[model samples]
Target chain A: MTTFVDIQDVTHVYARAEDGAPAVQNLNLTVREDEFAAIVGPSGCGKSTLMKLATGLQFPREGTVIVGGREVGAPVKLAGMAFQNPTMLPWRTTLDNILLPLEIVEPHRSRLRKHKAEYVAKAECLLAQVGLKGQGHKFPWQLSGGMQQRASLCRALIHEPKLLMLDEPFGALDTFTREELWCVMRDLHAAQKVTIILVTHDLREAAFLADRIFCMSARPGRIVAEREVEFPRPRDLEITYSAPFASLVQELRGHIAQARAAA
Target chain B: MTTKRHLHLAPWIFTLGFFLAWEIICRVLKVSTFVLPAPSTIAQAIWEYRNQLAFHAMHTLWMTLAGFGIAVAFGLLLGMALGASRLINAGTYPLLVGFNSIPKVAVVPILVFWFGVGWVPPVMTAFLISFFPIVVNVATGIATVEPEMEDVLRALGASKRDIVFKVGVPRAMPYFFGSLKVAITLAYVGSVIGEQNASNVGIGNLLTRASAAFEVPLVWAALVVLAVLGVVMYVITALIERSMTGWAQRSDMAAA
Candidate 1:
């Protein structure tokens, strides 16, 4: 498998002080095309910092962070991101929020005026995928928390980006909604074939959604363990209760506990 | 006519009650009309000069609207510009504060000197007073957007123009309307003061003339006209605000 996202020993330090505490020190990771990977770690472990580096929202102080074989400078137009909060613009409706990327980024930007109806149809389709088909005209505040996150996911995927980065996207959701979103996301990846990098604290979430999980240490986050889930595809919520699933989650939890102690 | 009697005649009940008591006291004490005209005499004066008062009231209304329109335009453009530009914000912020601090009424004489004894002085006075609330409100609104919201746009590679027009403007609408509601009332007061300082045919000028000539009844009538004008402007602004922020209001309604 080809490595689509390659981070070559990246180090990120905040410029304000010399506390000798970097956000991420000598971090290296590569995500292959069509891979579903999760990074889980102790609190304040800079998992989100790694996501930022991968998406080109922030540049590493030293070394190269490349996505799709190109050095990340400004944010990549071909990448999509969803934060823990939906961060939906209150002014726009669900349909407009989903169509935001298309309106802002190219080759969709120039084509938006000419292909508005087609793009609207595309947004509607994505909304339907996330179980918000007819609620496109509703504002973000009108929807529930789970629905807003779903709409935000649609916004991220609207432009058909190659890489999707989720930073604790389901952290704010209820347990049932979170599990349901896991299936929604699983199906999305299955259909889209986009590389997904999820940064989460929930061991169960990592075990359930990701094919592989990378566990990291606190503060200056570094990979402490890597585990692969050989579970079958189209994972239902029922799979989380199986013996193998429980073992994997517990094993990852143990690694996190040790990492926290060491920190 | 019955509804009118019930509604319009309601205020006079108290006024008539006070006057009847006053007339009884004044007749007993023998107080002069120059000091406190009897309610019957004031009513007679208003009935006789109703046409003249209406003409002056129309002039004041036109001046108020003109000044208000200018203030809204100036406030929105200046607010958006200062809100958008950090350098401009830094440079003009102190100046705006200084201008706002100076009692706009103190500048009425200067406005009169510059624009002469016509409608210009009152219009400018009203603009000076009314424009600041709108500018401050709009500037604050534009500045208060959620950082996370802007981040999403930034991460998506949205240009500054796109971010502002698509995001900032819509988000700032509620604040602008909020300010405008307050501003419109100020505009009316400012314009009236402006007209009072120097104008040929307006309620303010008539007020000045009435006071100078000791026509206390006409002065009261002009005050009543001013109050009516202010209420009308306020109602129009409220309607506009309701329409502009319909989405937000609907959300609040739903939450309720």
Candidate 2:
């Protein structure tokens, strides 16, 4: 597969960079087209900064971020993002919330009013795919945390975004819900064939979903190792109990622990 | 069912009980009307001066609403400006607080000097006094938009205007309506102050006249009317808030 997102020797400094440390220094990473990539690292490892740079929410002080083969100077219109918090607008129903990006990103923005019925149908289809069928009419607060996250995922995919950026989207959910969402995400990747960049602290989550995992060092983060999961498609929760999965998780944990000690 | 019914009737029962206690105290103490007219005497005075009371009350209502209308428009615009930019909010906030701190009653004389003894002073007072709460509340509502929420839209290459209208404005509705309830009550106080000093009509002017004439019961009746007006305006604002921001209300609060 062709490389869709490429970052080269990127260095980013937050305006209020605490302790005079850049958020991410010499951050080099790439994800191929339609690939499931996960970045796992120690706390304050600048994984979020990398996500922001890749999505063009923030510019790197030095080096380049290219998505879809173009240098990113502004927020990439083709990217859809979700965070730890679902951040659903309380005022809008689930369906409307899912349709929010369409109202902003064009050609949908221009055609939204004229073809709202079509868009609504599309949103309902996505909702059903995420196991939130027939719950579109309710406000977001009416749903449970896991349900809200499901709605959030549907929202991220509704505009048919080419790139999906998920920042610990399931971190707030319970363990069972998290595992369920992992399955949901696995199926979504298989069906949609969309590029995904997941930033998470959970090693099991990374090993379970990502085709390739990038491990980063603590403070002023930079990728220290990359491992490919040779597991076949249609990964199941049962594989998590296998010795290979535990060893992969242990190895990733060691990298993080060493990175933390170096700090 | 009975608990729910009691909850429904609680406000009435408490209000009537308060008045009954005041009436008993007044009668048992043989308190002079000038000191504290009984609720019964105030009710009698309200009946006796019903026509005059209605005219003044209407005048006051008009003045308060007019000032409140202006405040809402100006406050919303200014609040948007302040809320949209941190620099603007910081630079203007201290000035706003200082201006609000200067008792609006003191400004009534200044207003009277500029506009002279009429509706203008009362209207200006109400506007000045009421706009602060609205500005603060609306600005707070907009400023509180979660960074993650903005990122959801911003990541889609949404414009600043899109972010404001989609997230900021709708989020601020609850705060705006909440401030309206507060602003309306402040507007009444402002109008009354202006009327007591400058205006020829309104309940405040009537209040001053009745007190000067030693019609203590009439003065008490005017105050009652003002309290009732304040409560009615508050309820109306709350109803509007419920309709507009039902999503923001918790289940218990919405049910209530």
* DockQ metric, candidate 2: 0.89
Cα TM-score per model: 0.88, 0.97
Candidate 1 chain B: minimum summed lDDT over ten consecutive residues — where? B247-256
Residue-wise lDDT of candidate 1 within B185-230, one digit each (tens)?
8888888888888788788888889999988877776776687788
Off by over 4 Å in 2: B251-256
**How well does candidate 2 score on lDDT at residue B146?**
95
Candidate 2's residue-wise lDDT over B106-163, tens digit each? 8988897899999999999999999999999889998888999888899899988898
Q: Point out the worst 10-residue segment of candidate 2 chain B by lDDT.
A: B247-256
TM-score of 2: 0.97
Which pairs of residues collide in candidate 2?
Answer: none
The DockQ-based CAPRI class assigned to model 2 is: high
Scoring each candidate complex against the real one, what DockQ results? Answer: 0.44, 0.89
For every candidate, the chain B TM-score is: 0.82, 0.97
